[model samples]
Target: MSVRKQQLLKQHRRNKRIALLAIIMGLLLLGFIAPLWLLPLAVLLVWVVHEAWFADHLFYSPQDDYQYRFPDGVQPLSLRLVNGRLQLQESSLAQQATVIAKVQINSSWLGRWFDPSICIGNDQQTFERGAHGVRYLNLTGQVEALTTAGLAVQGRFCSIATQIQLYVFTQPSPTAGNMMILAPHADDAELAAFGLYSGANNVSIVTLTQGEVEAEYYQRLGLSQQHAAQLKGRLRAWDSMAIPLWGGVAQTHCVQLGYYCMQLPKMAKQPDVPFASQQSAEADIRTARRHNTIQLPGDATGLPTWQNLLADLAACLMHFKPDVLVMPHPEIDPHADHIATT
Candidate 1:
């Protein structure tokens, strides 16, 4: 920014703050004070005034930035997204550049109200500063790679970071080879990568859990929580194994590990501790195992512990010896299990 622009922005903010204080003073002079019993309503009235003044500049729904396009050279960023920095050039950024990306960062409701000043070179813009489903980032005359844009999503840690692609990139075609697809739940394999490896040869689908925690999905069947959960697992497990047949995977190639849903990270964290299923209340995976086509590899623990899952997954890998492996991107997938699957 030029010295003139910087001065103007500073003056602008100072004016807003002064104006806000003036409003408060004016209200007080106007005898706007309320009785003690109306304290809650008084606070609400003050908040209304503040929001009305900030409605145009401070608040924005990030989801509104759904569609974005970039000029013809940017490709799929080849560099690692270590933190939020899009490390394009090895040097510091030049003062002038362009908005090369339309990014959608997952943030909390509170975070949405406050802009995350994304830094690209010396240019730092916020999600509220751009339009059309993308956060504009500055990237041009590279002066340094030391600069960065970081996201501190409120309410929770970072979740899915979906963004529109502005860069140009090529993808290779899938070929015949030993390939394995690991689904954290029943349909994840299909939703996350059906088109990715459906045409590939020698594909194996490995479902880690029966998704027993989704028992609420079967509540209409007039069954108890445990029965409904167990039933959902059985049905979804079959969907996980059988649906891929249409995609050309051999029926025998699909297998289920028969663990509970939403409990994977816990199982991994407490590998030795036996965590019972919240839905089934059963301390074992025997029910889910009944739907498996492939046997547990090696002397599998068959217990609901993290070590057994790791051992089972390792054995499956050895059995397939896949040339290519497919799993969720821990940084991108929203589900915790999907993140743990990787």
Candidate 2:
């Protein structure tokens, strides 16, 4: 045998010996320190760690006779292992191209490793160890007539066989449209629809309540009055700032209905629930009466508070006229306000 082949064989033998020694030591340690009930888990963990460590350094020769052909009328594609790194090459007329490739690495003991990666051009991609074996990567880049890409996979493992399939496609342009997000609280819209808000041409957020009940609840929890006030103010401020930032435009409308927090559904079900503090409730009644926003059938004294809420929401819907409406799922959501809003 050649000197290089001899060296590789010797190194592989040494790696096997080291791996065996590590597993024995781990078993002994677990037997002494780990409880009987945890022995199985400890053994499994030790075996996994040993296998991963072994795979990280092992190298396998690629089958020289293996040949890969590109799809009919598509760009020519080629893959080869060079100095422990996988190199992918493709010929294209476009200046930039998106390459999507699926790579399968098979190990005798440890199941198949599905590491799919995308490469635009000469970009380098890294693979990290995953639960099953290793997670793949995606690459993006710009190239001339010919594109060359290299992937450096961590933890060199001998693959029984490696299969790679490549596909090329263009990315679609961004779409524009009107989007409406309804939130039971100030921050809910940002939390749920930030992606839509950022991408859509026009976005409107309707926050149903001021969430003052949160401040009251915090106070009831023994927080200082000043701290509670600060928390409430911060929540409102973040809600306002987050929408503008996510929407990428100041033209977005933020409609605040200023309803009592934590009481909408309760008031709808039982109008006598007393949604606000006595002082605030009396003040709100006076304001509603003056604005003529509160119109109830029969006596005003017997009206349900959620009727006004529904009316205000209807008015908002009529004005915004959104093509898409994003709201909380009624049955799936556990929050009373979210369910009520839905």
Each candidate structure's TM-score, on Cα atoms with residue i matched to residue i, is: 0.54, 0.42
Tens digits of per-residue lDDT, candidate 1, 1-342, equal 556547656766887899789866765655555555565565588788567535453223334554455555654543444454454443333434332444555554544545445554446555442223344443433323333343222212113244333343232334456789999998888887888668787898889888878567588889999889878888887888789987888777887887788888897788887666778777666666665666774235557778888878888888778878888987557688888888
The sequence of per-residue lDDT tens digits that candidate 2 reaches over residues 136-184 is 3343444332245455443332241244444555543222456677888
Best by TM-score: 1
Each candidate: what lDDT?
A: 0.65, 0.54
Task: Provide the clash count, candidate 2.
Answer: 3
- What stretches of model 1 exceed 4 Å from their correct place? 1-176, 298-301
lDDT of 2: 0.54
Model 2 CA deviation exceeding 4 Å by range? 1-175, 216-238, 241-246, 249-252, 271-274, 277-304
Worst window of 10 by summed lDDT in candidate 2: 285-294
Model 1 whole-model lDDT (C-alpha atoms): 0.65
Report RMSD (Å) for each prediction in the order shown.
13.8, 14.5
